[model samples]
Target chain A: MGAMSTESDPLSVHDQVVRSTYACIARFGMAKTTVEDVVRESGLSRATIYRHFPGGRDELLREAVAWQIGEFFIRLADHVEGSADLVELLDRGIEFARQAVREHALLQRMLVTEPDRLLGLLSTESTKTLPFIAAYLLPHLERARAAGDLRPGVDPVDASDHLSRLVLSYIGARGVVDLDDPAQRRDLVTRELLAGILRP
Target chain B: MTPEASPDVRARLLDATFVCLARVGIAKTSVDDIAREAGISRATLYRHFGGKAELLEALGQRELTRLDAVFAAAVQDCATVGAACSVLVVEGAEFLLDHPVLGTILAIEPTAITPLLSLGHADAFLTAAAALVAPHLAAHVDDDAARLRGAELLVRITLSHLQSPNPQRSITDPQVAQAIVDQYIVPGFVGKSAIERIQA
Candidate 1:
């Protein structure tokens, strides 16, 4: 079962391995996916994958998760666009998160088939994820702070962590809010969240 | 006498559900197993609970009741919105995270339980959690719906942290949890100056 590749460049093999791992998790779940599946999916030899991820399956899975999150944040930045208005930014962030959870292949598979595993990783590894997200948000938050959009005494690091946690909570609970309606999403994010940190 | 709708039966069934869940997890714990564990016939189990879903729902409610008691006690003496909410949020997170049944379900059966965390249930929980702090909030913030909104935010924040805690931060630690509440949560209920004054 060789992966169909349009490009044979050396760097693409790394990308191919990561993508294959993600697809295996999406199809088989964390508990059931094996290194052999990654090898088969990627059309790469087991030795090659082991060379790249010496820790084996777990390492590959970890890398895959990081890659997926990295890509997600990039898309998130585009949608949020560093809005000066915290409320508007939060509204957009919530919308993007809801859609991501619903549509992201990896996330949907994880949520449906191995939610506990996903939650376990999130709870334990979120320390890594939080800083990663906060760093991504640092620039946006700093820009907002400079524009005087944030309330006095708000730290961008703190704000990024707090906002990231807020978004993660909404995403995890799934039923905490009606993400279906755009107006309601704005109202909840603004009234419940932005009001606390954003300038009046 | 096997009274079909006895509280004793409900309690017995819930206890059995906990034992089975702890041992084999939600995916493996079946209605038949619960009934067998409770030493009741399948007919009796069905007589009490419509099915496995109904029984699990009841288990969730039972856990919420236990949590409500913890939250009620935690906020009993607090006078201000921030004071009551910080205590409630911090204590609630600890209680939920430490509770054997809920913690196990969250760790092992996350996918099946997402719907249980949905907005409707969360709103209901928030409304209940807020009612405890509403009187205190009323004495402080004159704005209508402030207490309800604050409760929702507090609960959401706590839920988020519990679900996906920062790797570097310990939500279970009182100092860390309190600081987060102080920085991100308190200001939502009280104005920024109130937090500033308290900090100063």
Candidate 2:
């Protein structure tokens, strides 16, 4: 693979190393993942990997975690795309996010065995994450407002931030609404989650 | 060591644990330090709590109970959901952000604290907190289920802010809290027309 990729695009090489690091962390756990493991997994030489990631293992790990998170959000955005209105958008987004996290094997294992490492990564990333989510939802919220679905005096920026925070919170922990139950999930999105922002 | 520990002694030990935790953090706090801080023997501390884990768990419970009382007092006389939410957000932010032990722990050993405030481990805390705050919200909402959902949403948003406070605005600021309550929270429980009435 190294021989075949000797002349590969630089970005692809960087992506290969990051992908390998993610796999290593998933299989060996964060604490045990090493530079050598990433090299072996990616079938790349130490010198090549070092050349791609100047900061070596630490940089590789950070980038890998970040890349995976970005991918997760991208997938989530795609999953909830084309919702007719704000209510449907939130309903689909929240449900998709919950299911994805619950089904993610690495996240599940980290939750049980290495919560600190996982949470540390998330908390540090959250500074960027919240704003990104809010930005993504802003247009949809505005559309809802234009459609006369939003309550009076609901600014899209504040409402986007509000919705982003609430969604993130629900994703982190189970609350009163059971997303697994369809009826409850609908009620959560419509009657409760969107109540203050939406028109009666 | 007394076989039956007095409630006073138990409370003192928990208080001491908080001090120790603030000074040395969760990972470094020792039984001897807690006992010494409490002005009690190790045996007496043991009589009150089986171990550090049990003591910490009890302390968590006590803190929640205390929070319930504080929340009740803060929102007791509010005439509307909007007023209650403003008081709740401002008061809750002040309570958590100004807490000596939590403030210290967040500063010195955030990684150790992040897990407890994040996913998996945060479920129990979130549930209890939502339950404690739900009744106050019930007075303004239509039914029991909506009350619970609104309470949980509010609790989650408050916690999210606590976990990762916005750089631009502090929730502890009354004006910011009120803005958040008006824009995000009150609308969720009270419908648009009612919100207009309240605003008017």
Candidate 3:
């Protein structure tokens, strides 16, 4: 364990705890991870973690999962920043998200060994995740509306929320659409995902 | 113990499994409990299913068959894609939300149920749902790909709402479901002229 410095920055302390907790979960697993593991990984005292998170282990786990989801969206937002239109934006966003999930070793492992833990995070954290996703897509939808690319009378807020839900579903589940094939991805985006919001 | 495995006995065992799952959580339910619930001997249960995993798989298969029948019945009377989709969304939401076993599990141990609906296992669920609903949609949607895409979209949206229902828009409400159908589902499957005609 590192020395307990006199650092009084609450934000930095919170960040360190969360990052350490994520690492612990990635290494040990959600069900088996404990406060001791986090304390050891974080190089922080049990008192410090309890002070920051009054709820202790449960609170730390929630925060860690939320932090990971936040990091994912931040990367996704950056990847999908600039696009020609809504279709391209959706196509890229879907592809990027699908690929990211597939390549996430920790997530895949968690899904196999401890699905309940991961599903619990998703269902509870969706309250935060959905709004975050909607906010990320709202600007693009608004720009599309301004460019006359969107259907008349389609509200950008509603459209963004709708798109966010679909994108989240597609990312989690690989239904009929073969996202690996560029042609299928484009067809899905144009004909189904964007059909309601975009102008013909 | 019956030497031959009858379809009726298999259906009975699956029904009993749901009863046991509803009564106790998945982790607590066992083959003995399921056999007792079905009023059958342990030998008969083993004769039907090799073990718990096989029994659960059969339960999942049974649920899908029932869901397909529900979807088929829901859209049998509709003349247009928009009308059929509206009925499907509302009816589908109500069916999933009001299922006794799912409601009990969700209330008691959501972690036990959420994985099957989303995350790693959701792909098969969504694929099966789409396949079941696509033929009904094909009657109205002219394009083959559009029909499948529309069916999958409907399933995805419904499942998403069931997982995290919107405060502003409840899919079980007919007016709200119709609004979603008109704004999101209908346009994707049909053209602008058809939308106008359907609305008119």
Candidate 4:
């Protein structure tokens, strides 16, 4: 839950390294962030950092990205918490996802400062992120399906995968619908997402 | 590559770009590499394109043009826009996934391609797709705007699927891809009555 484990425990060195790598990504973007940068931020020596991540800076960076995305999903779940209306909840959740991706410290930095680095994170690296996100979304979709919100014969797994793909599409390319308009956003969900997957 | 000098010049440059991208990838792929592969000097390459950026843009344009033509041909024989929508997504997904140039670039260096995949280009892609699909939709839908709207949503959904395919389901699966078109895309263009009639 915490970004960093307490420094009092030396055994939490891996967490410290990961936290430092995250900070370095936020500050310098992923392309420029080096193992030395993580070492400097975490106050760990090069030997210790290398011991934790034998693959070096890229390994550390990937772990840091995973950590950041996990934190992001937690915050998103909290934001979409307690909504009784499934459509509204989905709309809000998707909007939150869009803003979260657009404003993510690392993603924003990469888009503005080091765009080439952002590509791998979105493309191939997405092999990891997409499944992770779908897993996070599955429970909610299953709940909706159980409530008879989804169409008959619609698999919850498929729906969740579809939703995740939809969200990623928005992140990479804005939809034709205006996301800024709550009504339009709701229309997109009801028409594009819900109608497509839900009972007609 | 083509008969006319201008067309030949463009085709050669794009082909060379694809070759370089397939071989060395986008980051290491320079104008010089493309020129060398095309059997032309850098000066000749420059005469055709303003710079590397322009060349890259031209390649993107050529790719889209080819895609548009494919979609047009795929949908031309369909009796209904709803049917065309189904064929378009399935065939389009196949084309994108099986495309040597696109698949190779996305596989080897997705990071280099992300910038071009931004929201700014989504509009262009949607518009191009709509232009090809609208004629088919127009034959079914009375309202021109409604036809265009349906095509836009269809393009949006297809693009999302192409970008982030379900890990479990194959994009090449006709059953799954057809279901997406049936559930999501068709109803927007054809009325519910028509959909039922078509399905029946």
Measured against the true structure, the TM-scores of the candidates, in listed sequence, are: 0.70, 0.87, 0.87, 0.80
> Chain A TM-score, candidate 1?
0.78
Q: Whose lDDT is higher: candidate 3's or candidate 4's?
A: 3
Q: Which stretches of candidate 2 lie over 4 Å from their true place?
A: A1-13, A43-59, B1-7, B138-142, B190-200
- Give the higher-lDDT candidate: 1 or 2: 2
Cα distance off (Å), candidate 4, residue B118? 5.9
Local accuracy of candidate 4 as per-residue lDDT tens digits, A36-106: 88878988789888887899987987788667766776898789888776577779888897787766655
Q: Model 4: per-residue lDDT, tens digit, B74-180? A: 87787866667777777777777777777777777665555455544455666766766666555567767667767776666666666666666665687776777
- Residue-level lDDT tens digits of model 3 in B2-67: 433666888889889989887776778899999988888998889778988898888878886887
Share of true Cα-Cα contacts across chains kept by each model: 0.25, 0.75, 0.82, 0.43
By DockQ, the candidates rank as 3, 2, 4, 1
Better of 2 and 3 by DockQ: 3
How many steric overlaps are in each model, in order?
3, 2, 0, 1
How much does each candidate deviate from the true structure in C-alpha RMSD? 5.7, 3.3, 3.3, 4.1
lDDT (C-alpha) at residue B88 in model 4: 72
Against the true structure, candidate 2 reaches a TM-score of: 0.87
* Candidates in descending TM-score order: 3, 2, 4, 1
DockQ, candidate 2, vs. native dimer: 0.56
TM-score of 4: 0.80
A24-63: candidate 2 lDDT, tens digit per residue: 9988888889999998999988999998898987788778
| C-alpha lDDT (0 to 100) for residue B60 of candidate 3 | 73
